[model samples]
Target chain A: MTALMIINMRNILSVIMLGGIYSLISAILFVVLDAVDVAFTEAAVGAGISTVLFLSAFAITGKHHDLKRRNHFPALLAVLVMGAGLMYSTLDMPAWGDAEAPVHQHVAPRYLEDSYAEVGVPNIVTSVLASYRGFDTLGEVTVVFTALIAVLLLLGAIREDEDQS
Target chain B: MKKNPILRETSHVLIPVILLFALYVQFHGDYGPGGGFQAGVIFASGIILYVLLHGIKKTEKIISLQTTKLLAALGLLIYCAVGVAGMLLGGLFLEYNVLAADPVAGQHWGILFIELGVGITVASVILAVFYAFAKFEK
Candidate 1:
């Protein structure tokens, strides 16, 4: 519904605002799913900072810009095929929260039961993220660090070079 | 945006609370639903709010670009240093079992410091990103 509304909207600013609302609604959906941590992140990031960033970028780029029309049939077909394939594939998976699901059968049980005793943290998610999977988290943090470097190079550093030239 | 008194006053009131909430989320992750990543983004959003209401020029006076860059690197280094510490302490890389008198305590210490590193890097990197985007305005 909101996606359709956004697609039909012609104003870039309104579109961005509606996208932020979509993010907020998804964050609320995460909350409804009992993923408080994920909801917190989605609300803070997707709803809050990201919206601000997008608005700022839009402002910097231009105001009162027109949407450019382009070829859409190929893209539309590709999206429909991908969507159908994904939906068809999901029909073979186990139901939500099934005990025999691959995700629940693996390390999750161990983390759920023993993480508190082993890691001395009541929150199993944090224990798993920081201790049992420390290497993975280290890699993730490195990725975040690397993203800053990339953005700085493209926007911050390159801009300076052009300014001087 | 800066010219609006309501925006300025509200942000002034809200920024401190947001930062405090971030710290709470960071330290209380062991017992709660939040951790470094969430807390870090929340913290950066506080600074972004300041920049929004007060303008980037004034915001930079308090948190210089160099400071954010340095903090980002420092955070990455802190995480690496913890891993290296594990090695030097007769454990494998990032093995928390050797960091304290007991394995559990070592785990606690290791996770705390590791999350700290993650929080620092995430917050600074986010601020740096906002700065980059804001710079394009003028």
Candidate 2:
């Protein structure tokens, strides 16, 4: 919420830095939730790479914030509605760390029981992510590859055009 | 950035440590908390730091744009090759049990290779993007 306030103030650099901080805080939250792997990713990608990417991209544009004041009521309304809807939905969800949760009941036990025997990796997250869901990880890598190609194509063409100009 | 010798020296000292940490995260992920994605981003950030401190031209001399592009593709290829190798070994795609005499060892090898592939591709692609953005002129 404080990050949102910083962003709303129209300071681009501050916004980027605050965004990094927000990611870092969320990473800490993930650690509290016992998801160290998720925390690691959140810290690396969100706080580190994203902040650098934003700053570098900002270099292409002027640094000063535009002083255009516009109505933000519609956006505020949309956010409020979405937040209310999400909160309302969460009321029906299982309590945090509940053993009787549907997710805990289904597939969790099997993974816990068989992962060591089947995959031989002590880290169940590694086994599940790399071995059990190898195809999905491959798809994700392909997606990253596609993103790189897209960036290259777009930026490379712009560079060529600039050179031609 | 070049005018600031302190920042330059500090980053020079820090980048190697960051990169070493990235490698540790990449290889030690099986036992610890990190994996390819986290390690890759950390590694790229180290390169990005180098670029920030010493202009992209110098960084390019260290790791050229063509090399980054090639590495990005090669990483993806390495991952796909692993899956195909599994198929050729008379198992379904990505089925690691057939990769060796011992299924457990095969799983380890397959995960290690795939994670390495993922780490390589992610690091190179991110570095490539950083290069593109850094190189762009208004």
Candidate 3:
């Protein structure tokens, strides 16, 4: 019982500390990649909002585990089968960050070089998003708006009821 | 009514500057790091500050719900119009070069129009969403 308690404490500490550390690192990485917009979003959503949301969820649902007997046989089998197929396919993938790879040689260069001349944006990513691939940005904005609407719908009715009381 | 003239004056004064900056960013996107999305957020932030300091009702008076909704729809329409212009000029949907007689300048104009559309849409939608959330909240 004592060992299990110690292990659980360690796990909780590691989860909190490691999650914070990784989030910080990822935020810096985003900055380094010149994705200030994405970096702002990551810092806001991941570091601030997500941490608070997780804590709130934990408060609503107690820390204690229910210890349900999760039937994992089918899940395990499926994962294993998928893992084997993935491993087989890995042979075809170009090595990570290979400069000579087709991905590096293709239209990506044109987007980077021509983005300024064509789109007139200093930030190539922004140019790609707002100009070159604006349709995708429009779709993404719609998705975010839809999500906001859905959340409002879920919580809005409760506010009205409480006001009536 | 507890009258605070300073906060009201400051925000009212700041709104025009913020909106102007948003316009500059929207148009000047081709040359700088600031673009439609960033400009939209910045513009929305100014309005949000007004809403924060003053009541939602006061903010609503300045930008009505109907107006915001119309602006959001208008932004999308502007984007579609640019696309249609490109198509009519014998280019693909959203193709910039075919937008004008000079293909290169046409691309520039096309991008500028598209960015403006994006900026307007994003700003209005964000403000509208904020309004939807804050309006009914006690």
Candidate 4:
């Protein structure tokens, strides 16, 4: 176990800093994967809005967390089994960033090379999202719309008495 | 309603740049690392800034929660209408090439309409989310 800082202030700062680091790392990883749209979404959602929302939630709910360690045996065992299976599968996979990987030889190359001529767009990612695999993009838009609906249903209609209170 | 002068001034300066950048992103996606979603978020963020600095109640008067809900639905309809137009043109569902008699011109028209649909949907949805959050806190 890492030694806890005696100062509570240090712990809070460290957690916020750690979250910033994780968000930064994920944004870079998304860029590397050629998912610029996903990267932008994450950067805004995770780093921007989420941080504000969390802080607001904390303000409403208070700072002290309910620290009881709920039962963990099942969760730990499940995670361990999943990790072992993933390690076994990783052995048969092509090395990271290998140009000879089957993924590189597939239709992806066609999407990369011919997407401009095929779709008449310079950004192949947008072309893919708005044209080639448009149905999937439609699904994504629906998911966002559905989330808006859910947020509305969950917390939108304000009660008058609560407002008065 | 009196607000913190610094915040109001900062947002006054900031919102235009944000909206301009969003339009730039919407148009530049054909060449750069931006598209409908990014532009939409940037645009929504500008509105959110207004709400944050000026308070939700006042912002509501300007945009209104009811209008936002209607706009959200309208955005989806816009996207679907474009797809339906493609279908009517005798291509496969979402097939853009048949929209015009000339295939190249058809692709241009199709991509333009689709991008517009995407932009509209994204902008509205982002606004709706902000509205949700603002409403919840009140």
Q: Each candidate's DockQ score against the native complex?
A: 0.75, 0.75, 0.18, 0.49
Which scores greater on DockQ, model 1 or model 3?
1
RMSD list, candidates in order: 2.3, 2.3, 7.4, 4.3
lDDT of each: 0.89, 0.89, 0.67, 0.73
Q: Rank all candidate structures by their TM-score, best first, as comma-separated numbers.
A: 2, 1, 4, 3
lDDT of 3 by residue, B49-135 (tens): 677678778877789755776776777778888888888878888787787777667867877777777677777777766665555
Where does the lowest 10-residue lDDT sum fall in candidate 2 chain B? B129-138
Clashes of each: 0, 0, 2, 0
Instruction: Give stretches of model 3 more than 4 Å off.
Output: A1-28, A40-103, A116-122, A144-165, B1-17
Model 3 interface RMSD, one decimal: 4.9
Second chain TM-score, each model: 0.96, 0.96, 0.87, 0.88
lDDT of 1 at A109: 86
Please report how far candidate 3 places residue B46 from its true position, in Å.
Answer: 0.8
- Candidate 2 Cα misplacement greater than 4 A, ranges: A157-165
Predicted candidate 2 versus true structure: per-residue lDDT over B28-72, tens digit per residue: 988899888888989999998898888888888899878888898
Ten consecutive residues with minimal summed lDDT in candidate 3 chain A? A1-10
By DockQ, the better pick of 1 and 4 is 1
lDDT for each residue of candidate 2 in A1-25, tens digit (9 for 90 to 100):
8566775667777777888899999
Judged by DockQ cut-offs, the docking class of candidate 2 is: medium
Runs off by more than 4 Å, candidate 4: A1-21, A32-35, A56-63, A70-74, A156-165, B1-3
Name the 10 consecutive residues with the lowest summed lDDT in model 1 chain B: B129-138
Kept native contacts, as fractions per model, are 0.85, 0.84, 0.21, 0.49
